[model samples]
Target: MLKIFLSSTYRDLVEYRAKILDKLDTVFDSVGMEEFIPDGKTSHEICIGDLKKSDIVIFLLSSNYGSLIDVCRLKEDCKAECPMKTGESHISYTHCEFKTVIAEGILHQTYKVLKGWDTQDKKEAILFEEEF
Candidate 1:
């Protein structure tokens, strides 16, 4: 079975995420922070490791950029600042996950969902039109 890693801002897309999971559950196994991440593993380790194991990645984007965290800064060995930490950098966990997947040269697709709108309706409509 193919493993799919779903990437998106959790708080911003709770409803959309649930709908995606429900749709994906019938076909492929899906991985996300809420129901998949194992205990004892750090967020960075879990995300990167799981992303590496996944066959494909799906990104859900919105107007909200979400929160950012400096993984390099948190490490004791790395003294250099995170390259993504710039004046206009809105590197959320979802962003980092997407970057990691790209850096690994994995297959990915992105879908834009409007913020403050009915995400389930938008997602369902889009998925229905797409091959998926």
Candidate 2:
């Protein structure tokens, strides 16, 4: 079975996550970070386990939540995006939703979809067939 890790904050992206999960379930076995992480679990534990078990980790980036570290490194510690300041707003960056896809460690082949976006190239899609 193909394993995938879906990572995103619990507040904003629930609906988007559900859509992605539904599509992924049709093709591959998948898990989300929230399943293993509950009210009391430490962030470190959940993050580590999720990254370790998943063959590919899909991080859904948002304008206020983009990670600063390069995607090429799969390690836990990286510079996090600066926390948004209240009472003062700044101009947002372009393509903020999918900015996390090109991080230092991410492979170019893995997908990076923004909100309401669909895969345009089916020829490069990953298909799994049962072992003979």
TM-score of each model, paired residue for residue: 0.71, 0.47
RMSD of each: 7.6, 11.7
TM-score of 1: 0.71
Per-residue lDDT over 1-132 for candidate 2, one digit per residue giving the tens place of the 0 to 100 score: 877767654455778778988898899877775566565645444554455555666665432332322232322343323122221322122111122333334322223345422423322111110100
Model 1: per-residue lDDT, tens digit, 1-132? 999988887887899999998898899999887775467877867776787799999988765656666543433432223345453443456666665665668899888776554534444234322422
Q: Each candidate: what lDDT?
A: 0.68, 0.44
Worst 10 residues of 2 by lDDT: 123-132
Output the lDDT of residue 127, model 2. Answer: 18
